[model samples]
Target: MASWQQIEDDNPTFAAKVRSLFDAGTNKTIATLRRDGSPRISGTELKFEAGEITFGSMSGSMKLLDIRRDPRVAIHSPTLEPPADHPEQWPGDAKLAGTAIEMPRPEGDPHEGAGYFRVDVSEVSVTYVGNPADHLVIESWDARHGYRRRTRK
Candidate 1:
């Protein structure tokens, strides 16, 4: 897995675009695996700081318990529908998948009881509609593959 900083260093432009998508909204979606291996989706707020992506769950939250038991996770940036008159104006959507690393909370911190996890990104991707014929464009980065681009009609 690669850290967010590594992706940024390797592909600055693509990383910037993905970051912008995350910044465009305050709430994102996170997926986690339950004990029985069922999928669970939860609303979350993402923080990109100190070259890392992090999020915290409220004390004793199910999502917190889920992450503690299974770190594998996927987070999707907030989705925004294109304007009726300007479909091409959509900023795009982004996703990140990785294992979450629990971060230690400082003593007496305001949210010390909450659970925090730092993302160790295995994959990152963004999709958008291109100009002209509006071909679908997909750009992705992975620790093993580095970077890739694809387009479809």
Candidate 2:
């Protein structure tokens, strides 16, 4: 089987799924680990482009601080169902697991440390929604499919 990056590269539709959630959406609930080995959760608007995901953060944000101590994290994307008039049913839920890295931010970019965390996905899954293979369900207008940016040719 091909790798996630390879599959996403070969299929525009799959790539669109990852992009739709990162863009347009106001927040992504990111789960990370605290120093005490407890779970920590936070939400942030993220930017996904060029096969990379990025988000802003402050110097002392718990999420940022947690990432500093431990990089592994789980991310959840709230699936948006389309309206009834549409032809396809939107996905009910989805998730991705990966590592987070702090990118150096330029000076004066709001919070410190570039105010962003980048996640490199190692695994992705969709559950509770009808099998995605049925393109008809996804194509429906009533189903609120996750948002996607216009792809460049």
Candidate 3:
């Protein structure tokens, strides 16, 4: 896996995809490495800020314990809309591969009971649902004009 810095630097387009996914209100399912090196998967909120994604827990749950033991995590977000032009290639699934670390609770965070998880993505990829094409393209969006093609597989 590339270092977090390297992934962002080498894959700006991929990063943008991650950002778009967050903006679309996608719920990211996080897989954290357990203490015994087992995998623990849990749903996480996807919060988009500036140019990155941030996640926080609402219950300070067991998932937080798993995070403290291991930082590696994989996140998945199912597509909200099917790809218009390439139905086969983008039947619509998106995945984020990365390392996650718990961010310290802010002094006055409103969600004080909520735990925080921050991922430094290594790779962002997509796949279609039961299609001959093997990959999906991602688009970038903002308030002004909405989504535009950001990258191809």
Candidate 4:
């Protein structure tokens, strides 16, 4: 697992691309594990702050309960439909998988009672069609595998 800053320090270019995709829109999706081990998908907003990826849930929210019970989560970046006339111009989508750890409340936080957490990232990936739009490309980094690139027709 790695901190957001560690990933950026290790691979600035890849981090920047992933950040662009994430910043393309608001309201990303997060997947958490339920008590039954099923996946629960919920809307969320995350921020890159203090060298970490952080998010919060309203007090007593189910998402917070889920994380308190089990911190594993996956976050998907906001996405847009590809341009009908120019598929080659489509921006990629990004994903992050990690463990979310509860953090001490930050001073002067507006959501006074909300639960805040930071991710210890295990994997990150971005997928898109490459230049010329010939094939799909996936750039990925993982704690175990380091970094890799793959393409598909």
Please rank every candidate by TM-score, starting with the best.
1, 4, 2, 3
Prediction 3 global C-alpha lDDT: 0.61
Off by over 4 Å in 1: none
TM-score for candidate 1: 0.95
* Every model's TM-score: 0.95, 0.67, 0.63, 0.94
Worst 10 residues of 3 by lDDT: 139-148
lDDT of 4 by residue, 1-153 (tens): 999998898888999999889888889999999899999999999998778999988998889989999999999999778787777788889999999999988898878768989999999999987777889999999888877899988
> Please, what is the whole-model Cα lDDT of each candidate in the order they appear?
0.91, 0.59, 0.61, 0.91
Q: Which residue runs of candidate 2 sit more than 4 Å off their true CA positions?
A: 1-7, 22-24, 79-88, 107-110, 131-153
What's the lDDT for residue 30 in model 2? 81
TM-score of 4: 0.94
Task: Itemize residue pairs with steric clashes in candidate 3.
Answer: none
Clashing pairs in 4: none
- The regions of model 4 sitting more than 4 angstroms off are 110-112
Ranking by lDDT: 1, 4, 3, 2
- Backbone collision count in every prediction? 0, 23, 0, 0
Give the lowest summed-lDDT range of ten residues in model 2: 136-145
